[model samples]
Target: MYTCAACNEHYCRRGELEKTPSNCPCNETEEVEKFKELYLQEENYKLSYNSALVEAEGYCKKTRLEEIMDFANKCDFKKLGIAFCVGLNQEAKKLAQILKENGFEVCSIICKNGSIPKEFLNIKEHQKVRPGNFEAICNPIGQAMFLNNEKTDLNIILGLCVGHDSLFIKYSEAPVTVFAVKDRVLAHNPLGALYLSDSYYKDKLHKK
Candidate 1:
């Protein structure tokens, strides 16, 4: 019902409440107050304030990695955690090196930490990506629990699969941020599909 994505005017950003569409979220004054109160909480306030500063100071001037470092420094989070997919192990190593160079303690956990078989989840062999072969399930819950045990100040998710990443976030005790999403088709840049949605991918993107 909230059709803000389809709105053209974007009166909310411009502070033109009178010109806002009927379905605009700005119309919900009560909801806004509730969110405002949430932002006032201790951890929430620090995160919201520092995130706003990171956005303003780095807008169009910093890569996501740089912004993440800047935000971490602002929040005074020293120990960083990485819950990464096995497919992106190399990328995770490079990121860990960079974070260490910047003087932060790094705690890294791989998706296949436990080496538990896919059958542990009752997944049939045919359902496996490669049938008749052993497949270790991606252990998002284990990653989160390990990071939690370390008391990581912040957790970075790298290239975890869709539902797997959700499970990681759900189990993580620290503040979570996504470093990259899995999209092997587009070199992990999923936005390329959206950019082509009205052109090369029009038919593929739209449901029949």
Candidate 2:
């Protein structure tokens, strides 16, 4: 049995334990530590992932633009795709521009690309952020398909809605990186929930 000490959730090492427990026993600090040790240190991808991290850190510390260019030259990536929410179009455009300036072939797609209505999927009209206005459904599948058609080597996500991002990752053929998550309150910083856990997010705790 594999037990998640932070959650007190036991896994039989079977096909189950797909997602983390909804009700975790450990506080945010403890959870973060366990996650770092397990995912960063022991994870299979740690070797390649940590090598990139170390290289990026060293590139930032001991390199000029020329050295950085030389470092990026080693990456096999060619075409880059950016899929972003319409709300964050400006930010996405800026990011695309930066990437283009850095010599990457960039392809940017807005969330409302196909203009497919949310009602088509049987989603309640009233539940939309802009009711009565023509609202486009978040087209994660389309975004991924479009990027796949473009044959992008790498895809970057900026401000994709929580569940939609998951679908995008599932469908995408290229490797994906998240530049910004869809947390509007914390200004793209999800850790703010952990930072002020004792105060603003005290309600999150099951027992106090």
Candidate 3:
């Protein structure tokens, strides 16, 4: 079991294992060597190098949108794709506009674009948010296919639901990044849970 989170001495920063706990992954020499080999690959090296540059350039200085634009610029990506939940259509539209203004060719797809019925997934009537109503399932695959057809260079997730975002990322051919995550009760700011973990949401998050 990995217990780095419970460790107090983070000796990995100095590339030293002297103070690493017994269970630390750093102690697993074979696995660490394999992971390093992966980063040595040409494509992997470029991806990681550019990601590091983006992080360093934008650290605590630039907004997320600005950072994304900077990163895309660095990667020379001309076309961008957005997969957004239906509930966040307005925000998606605004994001598309911003990307366009930033000189990117934007392709935006809504989660319910294909109009696939929830019944096709064998979901029971009671499973629907509103029973007896015609509900459309979120088609993350369709969103990815549409963007793939458009040959988008990078895909941005606006506010896809939890599992839906995973499906979208799985199906997307291009590199993916998340701009926002859907949190209906928290206005799409999921970190509110962490921010209040010590007080407001403590009992709910740590149930006895």
TM-score of each: 0.97, 0.70, 0.93
lDDT of 3 by residue, 1-208 (tens): 9987887878897877877888988899999899999999976786788889999988999999998898888888899999999898889989999999989999999999879999999999999999999999999999999999999999999999999999999999999999999899999889999999889999999876
Question: Which pairs of residues collide in model 1?
Answer: none
Error of 1 at 43 (Å): 0.6
| Candidate 1 lDDT, 1-208, residue by residue in tens | 8987788889989999998877889999999999999999999999999999999999999999999999999999999999998999899999999999999999999999999999998999899999999999999999999999999999999999999999999999999999999999999999999999998999999886
Instruction: Give the number of the best model, judged by lDDT.
Output: 1
Candidate models: Cα lDDT each: 0.96, 0.74, 0.92
Q: Least lDDT summed over 10 consecutive residues: which range in candidate 3?
A: 42-51
171 Cα displacement, candidate 2 (Å) = 0.7
What residue runs in model 1 are displaced by over 4 Å at the alpha carbon? none
**lDDT (Cα) of model 1:** 0.96
Clashes of 3: 0
Which lDDT value does model 2 have at 58? 75
In model 3, the clashing pairs are none
